[model samples]
Target: MTPQDSAGRGLFITFEGIDGSGKSTQARLLAEALRGLGRDVVLTREPGGSPGAEEIRALVLEGDPDRWSAETEILLFTAARRDHLERTIAPALDRGQVVICDRFADSTRMYQGLSRGDLRGLVDQLHDLMIARDPDLTVLIDMDPDTGLGRALSRNGHEERFEEFGPDLQRKMRAGFLALAREFPARFRVVDGNRAIELVAAEVREIVLDALT
Candidate 1:
C-alpha cells in the first residue's frame, strides 16, 4: 500500500494499454460514471497533465520517431512526471479526490524502458528516487496488437510518433503491459478491450466502483 492510502488520502487510478486500446475513452467514461455517483474526480493524463508536462509531451510525442534516444526520453518523462505529481496529482489526492489518470509511469516503463532496449531497471530507479509512488489501482485494457495499431493509425493525429513504430511495437507493448500486470497483480485489474464500447465502459465502471468502496 502507498503512503497516501495508509494516511487516508484519496485513490489514484490509472489506465494502461497499448496505443488505441480505448484506454483513453474508458478513462473518460469512468470519470463521468464516478462523478455521476457524486464522487470528487480529478481526471487527467500523463506526459501532459500539468502545463509544464504538456510542453514535454510535445517534445516526446511529436517530431521524428528518433527525436531522442530512449535514455534521454526517460529523463524527460521523469521530469514531466515530477512536475505533474507536485502540481496536480499530489494536491488532489491530499484533498481526498479520486485522481483518474489516463496513463502514468507505466507508459514510460513500456515505451522508453522496454521498447528500444532493456531499460526497465533505469526507469524504475528514477521512479523510486524521484516519484516514489504508484497508483492505488491500474486498469489494463487488453486487446490484439494489430487491431490496436490499425485503430491508432486511423486517427491520423499529430502525436503519431510512437504509433509510427507500427504493429510490431504494439505487439511487444501489449505483452509488456500484460507482464507488468502480472508483476503488480495486487494493484492491477485487466479488462478486455475487444468488447463493445458500452460493455467495456460498464465493466470499467464496476471495477472502479468496487475500488471506491
Candidate 2:
C-alpha cells in the first residue's frame, strides 16, 4: 500500500543506524519516555515485529552469511516488513498510538545497497511498490564504525549474520545512512550516538518530543 492509502491518526517513528549503534536501546528509551507522558506507544522492530515477520526474521538472520543472495534477502525483508505493516504497525497507528520501530526500510536500503551491491534503485522500487509510507520522524543514531562493531560483537545472539560482514561494511553503511539523512532532511533527525547512553537518550527524547509538539 502507498503512504496516502494508509493514512492514520498516530505518529510513526523509526530508528536507523548500523548494528551496535544503540538504536534499539534508544528506541526503547524513547518509547518509555513517551509512555511516561501518558501517550499510547507501540514499540516494535523490523525484520520481525509481527508474528509472521518474527519467523521470517530467524530465517534471514540465523543462516550462513551466503545462504541467501542479496536480491533474495531483500525479498525476505520486504515480506517481513509487509507482514509487520499489516498485522502490527497499521493497527497501532489506526489506534492513534505512537509507533516506534527499531529499524525500517532504511536498513534494507543501506544493507542491501551497500554491503551487497549497488541495488539502491531496486530497493527504492521495491519499497515504493510494497511499502511506501516513511516514518513521521526517523532518528539516525550516528557513531563510529569501530565502536559500533565492537559493541555488536560483544552481544551474544544467533542474529549475527549481518554483523559478520565486519567493520569495513559497517563504515560504508554509516556513510550510506548519513547520506540518506541528508537526502530526506525533513524526516531525518541525526543524533550523535557516540556518547553515554543517558546523553544520547536525552537528546533523542528531546528531538522526538519536539516533533510531537
Candidate 3:
C-alpha cells in the first residue's frame, strides 16, 4: 500500500458511465484488487446502497415508464443518493477505508439534467447542500450509447423508465457526463469503455494505483 499523508486517510472513488458502460463490473474488479493489496475497501452503488435506498431503487427501476415525469425521476434519484451517502459512504471513508461506488452524483447530473432538462437548479443545489464530500476521484467509463443500450437491453430483457428513452436520449446522457467531466477535469479521468473487460480492467487498475500513489 502507498503511504498516506496525515490528512489523506481514506480515498473516495466514484465510477460513472452511461448504462451498460460496465461501470459496475469495473468498480467490482477495482475493489477486489485494492482488497488483495490489504486495503480496507467498501463497495457500493448509487440509488440503492442503503436498505431504504435499495427499496427505492427497485421502485425507480421497475415502475412503469410513463408514470414518472422527468422531475419525479430526478427527485427520487436525489432522495436515494442522500440516504446512500449518509448511511453507507460517509462512515466507510471516516474509518480510513477506500469506498468504490458504482455510481454517484454524476449519475443524477447526467441522467436527470439531460433527459429532464433544466429543473430550476434543484439537482445541483440539493447535491451541494446534502452530500458532505466530493469524491477524491471519479473514473468515467465511456462507450457508444447505442452499443451500451443494446448491451443493457440484452442483459435486462427489457427497459425501464429511463432506459426506454432509446438511443437518442442515451446519447445525450453521454454528452451530459462528458460535460460534467470537462467542468471538473482535475478530478475526473475518462476511460475508453469500448474494449474487452480484461483491457478495461487493466486501465482502471492503473488509474486507481495512480490516484493512491
Candidate 4:
C-alpha cells in the first residue's frame, strides 16, 4: 500500500521541527532514497518551491526577527503558501508524484502562531481560509534545543533571523512541536534527531515506508 493508490493522487510528506533539528537534511535524504527506488518524487521547500514564494522567503527569513509583527508575518507566509500550492505542490501531486517538502503550514503554526504571542487561532483561521492542504505525513525531527541552536548558528546562513531569536525560543518551539505531535498523532511521527545522521535517516525512512504500506 504505497502512497499511490488506485486513483493515483500521490502523497504529500512534510518535515517539521525546530531549526537545526536536521529535518531539512532528512527531507533531502528521504527524497533521494525514494528516487533511488524509482518513485516519482518532487523535493521542494516552503516559503519557497515556487518563484513568488522564494521572493517572500527572503523577506521573512532574512533581516531582523523583529522586522515584522506576527500578524504581518502570517499574511506574508499565507500569501507565499497560496502561490506555492498553485504553482508547485498541487500539480506535482496531481501527477502521482510524492512531494517531499522541507516545511509547510506547521512551521507557520509554530513560529508565528506560538512565538512572539498566542496567535495560533489566527494562523489556523488563515490556513483554513486560504491554504487548505495538510501533509499526509509529518516527520518532526526532535532535537535538544541547545544543540539545535548551536548547530543552526554554526551554519552562518542568511536565514539567521529566526536563529537569532536565540535558544529560549528554540526551547519553546521544541516543546510546542512535541505538543503539536500529540495533538495530531495520526499524521505526526516524532524521530529523535540527536543521533548520528545515518541513524536518524534510517528511522525516518522506516517510519515513512511503514506509512506508505
Candidate 5:
C-alpha cells in the first residue's frame, strides 16, 4: 500500500538491505531530517525495539553461528517483532508520529528465508499469523555484497551472528532484498547505497519527503 493509504494515521517507514548496506545510518538520517522539519518522529529497530524485544535480540544475535536452528530463529524473530509492534510501534503510530525503523519483517524474510534455508514460506506464514503490518514506505539501500560485507566485518561487535554468514550468503541476501522490492514496488524505494553517506542520505531524504507529501 501507498504511504497515503495508511488510514490517515502516522507514517511507518522502514529501511531494509543486506547487512552493512548502510540502512541503519540512513534510517537515523531520515528521522533526524523529519524531526528537523518539526514532525514527531520515533526512531526504532527490529528484533530489539522494545524491552522484551531487546532481550530477544540478544538471544538471536549472540553465541555461535548455529546457536539456533533456522526454524527456531524465525520463531524468535517473530516473537521479538510482536513485542516491538505492541510496545513501541503501535504506540507511536497511535500518537500520529512517524516511525523510522532500521529493519523490520523484511529482514527476517531475507535472512531466514534465504540465508538460513528455503523458508520463505515459513517467514510469510509466521508474519501473516502474527505481525502483518507493512511499512508505508520501505527504503532499500542496495549495494554490492562484497563491499557491504567488508563494511560489516570491519565493525567490532558481539552481535555478529548474521554477519558471520560471510560473503556468499550476503550476496544471496542482496538479491533477495532486490526481489522483495520488486514484489512491493509501490511501498519500496531502491536507493543506490554505494555512494558517499551524505549523498545516499540526501537521496533518502528526498524519497521520504515525497512519501510524506
Candidate 6:
C-alpha cells in the first residue's frame, strides 16, 4: 500500500513548544474546536499517553535526570513514542479521526538532539524506524525559552529535566525547533506563544481549519 493508504483517514497533528509555550493549552483548545466541528479527535502526547508510556514519562522527567545520557534520553522518548503510535495515534488516524498530540518527534530533536549533541541524524533515524507516517501538520509554538521557563516556574511551580536546561541549551533547542520547522515548511506552522492565550488559540484554530480543508 502507498503512504496515503498507510496513513488512512486520520489527520495527525502535533503541538511543540518549550516548557511554558502553552502547547498543552493550545493542543487542548484545538482538540475541543475540532470536536465542536463534529470530528472525532483523539488527544494524546508522547512519553506519557499509554499506561506504559506514562510510567516511562515519570522515570524520564521526575527521576534522576543526570543518570541518563543524552542518547539514552532520546531513545527513551523514541520508545515511548513508538508505543504511543502503535497503540493510539496511528489507529486513531486510520479511523478518520483527528489526532492532536501535545509533543512528538520534534521534541526529541530539540531537547535531546540539540541540547545533548548533534543528534539530528539520529532524530531522523528514529522517525524512519518508529514513525511510519509524518504528521499532517505540526504547530510549533515559538517562545523565548527563558520566558517560557519562567512562566512554567511561576505557574507549574516546578521544573523538569528539560525545563531546567540552561539558557544556552534552551537557545540551541529553540534553534533546533526552527530548523525542524524549516525542514517541513508545508507541514510546519509556527505560532507566536508570547501572545495572549485567546489570541494564540484563535490563530491555532484558523491553522487547523485551513489544514483540514
Give the top-scoring candidate (lDDT). 1
Residue 206's lDDT within candidate 4 is 94
TM-score of each: 0.95, 0.95, 0.92, 0.96, 0.95, 0.91
Clash tally, candidates in order = 0, 0, 0, 0, 0, 1
Candidate achieving the largest TM-score: 4
Model 5 regions lying over 4 Å from their true place: 1-8
Off by over 4 Å in 6: 1-8, 156-159
Tens digits of per-residue lDDT, candidate 6, 1-213, equal 322333336778999977778999999998887777677889988777788788788778875558689898888888888888888887787788889999988888777877778887898798798775678899999998888877776775322766666566667777778888898898899999989999999999998777766
Sorted by lDDT (best first), the order is: 1, 4, 5, 2, 3, 6
How much RMSD separates candidate 1 from the native structure? 3.3
Q: Rank the candidates by TM-score, best first.
A: 4, 1, 5, 2, 3, 6
Distance from true position, residue 179, model 6, in Å?
Answer: 1.6
**Candidate 4 TM-score to native:** 0.96
Q: What is the C-alpha RMSD of each candidate to the true structure, in Å?
A: 3.3, 4.4, 2.1, 1.5, 2.8, 4.0
Clashing pairs in 2: none
lDDT for residue 91 in candidate 3, whole number 0-100: 89
Colliding pairs, model 4? none
Indicate the worst ten consecutive residues by lDDT in candidate 3.
1-10
Per-residue alpha-carbon lDDT of candidate 4 for residues 59-83, written as tens digits (9 for 90 to 100): 9999988999999999999999999
In candidate 1, what are the lDDT values of residues 72-102, reduced to their tens digit? 9999999999999999999999988999999
Query: Candidate 6: lDDT of 129?
Result: 80
Kindly list the per-residue Cα lDDT of model 3 for residues 1-213, writing each as its tens digit: 462332247889999998889999999999898888778889999889999899888878785776677688877888888889889988888898899999887888777766777763777877787775689999999999999988877786433567787898889889888988999998999999999999999999998888887
lDDT of candidate 5 vs native? 0.90
lDDT of 5 at 56: 96
Can you write out model 2's per-residue Cα lDDT over 127-195, one digit (the tens) per residue?
A: 999998789999999999999999998898889998999888999999999999999999999999989
Estimate candidate 3's alpha-carbon lDDT, on a 0 to 1 scale: 0.84
